[model samples]
Target: MKLHGVDYTSAPSRRKGITIASGELHGDVLILESLTSLPDHAAFDAWLRQPGPWLGAFDFPFSLPRELVEHLQWPTEWAPLMRHVTSLTRPEMRETFKAFCDARPVGGKFAHRATDFPAGSSPSMKWVNPPVAYMLHAGVPQLLAAGVTIYQLHPGDPDRIAFEGYPGMVARDITRASYKNDLRSKQTPARREARERIVGMLEAGQHRWDVKLDAGDFREALVDDGSGDLLDAALCAVLAAWAWQRREARYGMPEFDALEGWIVGA
Candidate 1:
């Protein structure tokens, strides 16, 4: 089956954009194919709508915390809840979420999904820094509109399955070294070394996904991009391959709240 791993962005540009690693699984190995970047929302939407019988692991939150949704008294069902969320502008969402946090104690500002702990992911409601809340707002509706099936969360076209992915989990699995920095100034030799290690690990199937990389440009591409977007997308691609290998086994994802979807490789 066709597989992809996407490093997504809410607002993308030519310099900073979404990266997609596309490949296929051959027995236990995931053959690296190509990496494509979509620098804007229109490009992203067009890619999603492209004819696909493909499964993808996307680096974006698929759902908000069930507690947060309940606290806000929003619709608990997946589709309607997404509808309500996508209706608001980013500023409106920030204001509403800020109000929610303001009413609570300082340490308990954000409600987290069950998957967050194991995945080491930021709370889905976080609107700043990683801005996963905005990512969800920007990403999910498009996926739904494109007719992709989100496992355990929303049902759409069965031919295209979308699973939440966190590349950090896979990166940390290989080493604790800092591998990437979005800031050009922070892309140091140590980070490059770390990237090399990660590439080597993936080639060797050291992450225990039983998948090896194809030799050539794709492998070089993963290491050459010090920003780590390509590598992150590659990591997600490996996870997608793992999930595809075990498609009948629910992709190693645990029982997750339907409203708070699980990360695929968490």
Candidate 2:
């Protein structure tokens, strides 16, 4: 099957665009074919519309926390809720989520999807730090517009299935040491070594998925990027390969809130 793992950015530019690792699954091995960059929204939209009998694991939250959604009284269903969220500007979203966090006790600030704890992910409503909220704002609408079927939530193109994927979860399974920094000055040899170690583990099939990666000549680029975008995409590809193996069994997903989507393999 054609498979992809995407490392997404809410704001795309020449410097920090969305990165995709594309491959094909042959039996249990995922052969990495190419890495592509979408440096702008137009490019991303075009890529989405490309005919696909492909499955992808995307590194972005698909929906909001149920508690946060109920508290805001937004539409509870998937499509309507996304439309409502899209109605608000990023600053507006930040203010709304900020207000919710401000009223709660410290250490219990953010409302979480049940999957967050298990997946060890940032809350989908969090607007700063990782700024995943902005990611959801920018990314999900594209998926909806593209007519991709979001597993267990919304149905569109049956051939183009999307799953919520966490590259951090996969990376941490190898090591918790920091492996990426966006600033070139801060991209140290130590971090490069960490990326190499992570790549080595993938080559050896040491991750939770137990699926080895055949990265071919892409190995050096994956290690040298130091931003971790390439490696993150590869990690998501691993998760996608794992999920594909269990496609007949609900893609390895447990019972989860349809509105608050689950991270695949969590």
Candidate 3:
């Protein structure tokens, strides 16, 4: 399988270490690494205007859990729900999701959708641990700005193709929930073992459901001299590896089209 694609970037971001599967990924498979940590509305607006190979993003929380959506009495329908969500301001989205979470039981803090767990998605609204609600705030507007469609599991659109996959879900499954992400936690021997094992799986061609991860390809590299960038793309490379490893069904047989979210000929 030839991995042909272009990275949406301010600079060439691919790791100098990457090998195997080299072809330009269609220009739209974007790279949205935050330029300034918390990019403002203007920068975001500017990014949106550009034509994209990026259809959507690997959102931490592509959608909320079913229970949470019901709890807030947010629009149950997809089109209306997306419209309503985008209508809200940053603070508005945060406050609303937070209020809904606060009212729930402790173990089950946030309401999740069927897609959430399946996608191995982080709770977009979670206050700590990636706080994907911010990702939603950061990402959703870009989707809307591009007018790219999302692969939604909502009422009308059951067979949509999404740009961002909850690859962490796939990552966790192959590795199990053993490897926690924080710095101190990840350095432990046990976590190292877990990560190594995770690496082993990729190298061995284990998780056939995701794309080939090709972990060994970049294990020795430091950084890209040309781009001075690699971490985010490396992460995405990992995502693509896992995605390549997966069985096609895991993509849920996503549909790619203008209405489905891809920019035709863009």
Query: Which structure among the candidates has the greatest TM-score?
Result: 2
lDDT of 1 by residue, 1-266 (tens): 78999999898999989999998888888888889998898998899877778999999999999999998999999889999999999999999999999999989988899999988889999999889999999999899888888898888788888999998888888899999989989999899999999999888988856677663577777787879999999899988988988888888877878988899878
Model 3: runs farther than 4 Å from truth?
1-57, 152-162, 177-193, 208-210, 215-217, 221-266
Question: Cα RMSD to native, each candidate?
Answer: 1.3, 0.7, 8.6
- lDDT tens string, model 2, 1-266? 78999999999999988999999988888999999888999899989888989999999999999999999999999889999999999999999999999999999999999999999999999898999999999999999999999998899899999999999998999999999999999999999999999999999899888889999999999999979999999999999999999999999999998999999889
What TM value does model 3 have? 0.58
Per-residue CA lDDT of candidate 3, range 64-110, in tens?
A: 55566666778766556666777887688878877776777888877
In model 1, which regions exceed 4 Å deviation? Answer: none
Clashing pairs in 2: none
Can you rank all candidates by TM-score, best first?
2, 1, 3
Task: Tell me each candidate's TM-score.
Answer: 0.96, 0.99, 0.58
lDDT minimum window of 10 residues, candidate 1: 208-217
TM-score of 1: 0.96
